[model samples]
Target: MEMVVLENEPEVLMENISNKDNRDTSAAPGLKLYRCVAVSFGLLCILQIALNISLRPPLNHTNCISNSEDMTTNLTEERDELKRKLDDLKSHQNVLKSERDELKRTLNDFAHRSNNGWLYFSHSFYYISPIKKTWHDSRNDCLQREADLVIINSKEEQEFIQRWVKNLMWIGLSKRDGIWKWVDGTRLTQSLWCAGEPNNHKDSGEECGEIRGCGHDHGWNDEKCSNSNFWICEKKMAL
Candidate 1:
C-alpha cells in the first residue's frame, strides 16, 4: 500500500507543476505588452524634455534680438524728431532777425523823412536854419531841437560847415571870464580867427564866436552876443 501511495503522490505533483507552467505561458504576452507600454511612455517624456531644452535658447535669443531692434528704432525716431525741432527753431530765429532788420530800416527811413533839413556828416547830424536869430536865441533853439551850436573840431569839419553857410553863423565858441571856451566847457586849443579881428570893440564888446566867410584860411570872427545871424546845430550820432 505504501508503494502505491508514493507512486500516486509523484503523479499528483507532476500534474500540479504542469498546471503552473500552462498558466505562466498564457499570461506572458500581456505582461510583456504592459512593460513595453511603460518603457515607450518614459522614452516619449525624455524626448519631449530634450526638445524643449534645445528650442529654449533660440527663442530667448530671438526675443532679445527683437527687443534690441525695437529700442534702436525708438532712439532713431526720437533723434530725428529732435533734429527737426532744432531746424524749425533755427528757421524761426532767422525769420525774426530778418523782421527786426526790416523794422530798423523802416524806422530809419521814417526818421530821415520826418526830420527834414537834418543832414548826416562825419557821424553827426547838422541842421542849418534859414532864419536868423541872436546868439543866445540860436543856442536856445538848438537846445530845443536836442542839439547844440556847431563846435568845429577839425579844419575839415570847419570847411564842411562853411559849404552849407551863406553868411555869418554863430558857433559854439564864446569868451568866458576872458578865456576862450567851447559850449561844452573845453578850453580852446586851436583857432581859425580872421586876421586883425577879435579886437573886442570897446563900445560893442564881442563875446561870441562866429564863422565869417567861406573858403578862407581865417574865417572865424568874434561878435557881440546880441547880433542876429543864421546858426548851425550839431548832434552826434548814437554810439
Candidate 2:
C-alpha cells in the first residue's frame, strides 16, 4: 500500500506543473496584443500633431496678404487721377494752339492790304501816307480812316518811327493854351525833342509837333499847325 500511494503522488505533481505552464503561455499572448495596440495609438497621436502644424498659416503671413491687397487698391486710384490731369493739360494746349493760329492769320492780312499802307509793329498797326498835307489836314485824314495820328509813347516807338520817316512828319503832340498834351487827352511825361525845342517860337505860334528828318537828331520839333508834312496814323489791329 505504501508503494501504491507513492506512485499516485508523483503523477499528481506532474499534472499540476503542466497546467501552470499552459496558463503562463495564454497570459503571454494577451500581453503581446495589448502592447501592439498601445504602440499604434501613440503613432496616430504624433501624425495628427504634424498635420495640424503644416495646415495652419503663420500670423505674419496672413497680415502680409491683407497689406498687399490694400496697396494695390491705392496704386490704382493714383494712376486714374494722373490720367485725368494729363487729359486736361492736353485740352488746354489745343486751345492755345488755335489762338496762336488765328493771330498769325490776322497779321498776314494786315501785311498785304493797300489802304494807307498798313504796317504791323509792336502789337499795333501804322499807316504811312504817300501824300503830304498840313498837320490839321493829316489829323483829319487819320480820323476818316478810323485812326489817330501816331503818338510816340516810348523810346522804342520813337526809334521805330524814325526808320519810316524819310522827311519831316506830323505827330500827335501839340501845345494847347500853353500846356503840352497828346491828342488822346493824356499829359506828356516823356520828351523826345530836339535841342531848345518847345520854345513856342514867336510866343505860341509853333503849337503842333513834327518828327524832323535825318539831319537834326531825328527828334521832334515844334512847328506851325498849318505847316505841310507827311503823317503817320496808328490804330489797333482788328482782332
**TM-score list, all predictions:** 0.53, 0.52
Residue 62, candidate 1: alpha-carbon lDDT: 80
Positional deviation of 102 in candidate 2, in angstroms? 11
Q: Pick the candidate with the highest TM-score.
A: 1
lDDT of 1: 0.86
Candidate 2 per-residue C-alpha lDDT over 1-239 given as tens digits, one digit per residue, 9 for 90 to 100: 35444668878999999999999998998999999999999999999999999888767977899999999999999999999999999999999999999889877667554344777678678888898899899999999877899988899988888878867899998888778888998888899888888777887599998988535558888999988899999876775
Highest-scoring model, lDDT: 1
At residue 112, what lDDT does model 2 achieve? 53
TM-score of 1: 0.53
Looking at model 2, residue 187 earns an lDDT score of: 85
Q: What is the lDDT, from 0 to 100, of the residue 134 in candidate 1?
A: 95
lDDT of 2 at 66: 91
The local distance difference test score of model 2 is 0.85
Cα miss at 225, model 1 (Å)?
0.3
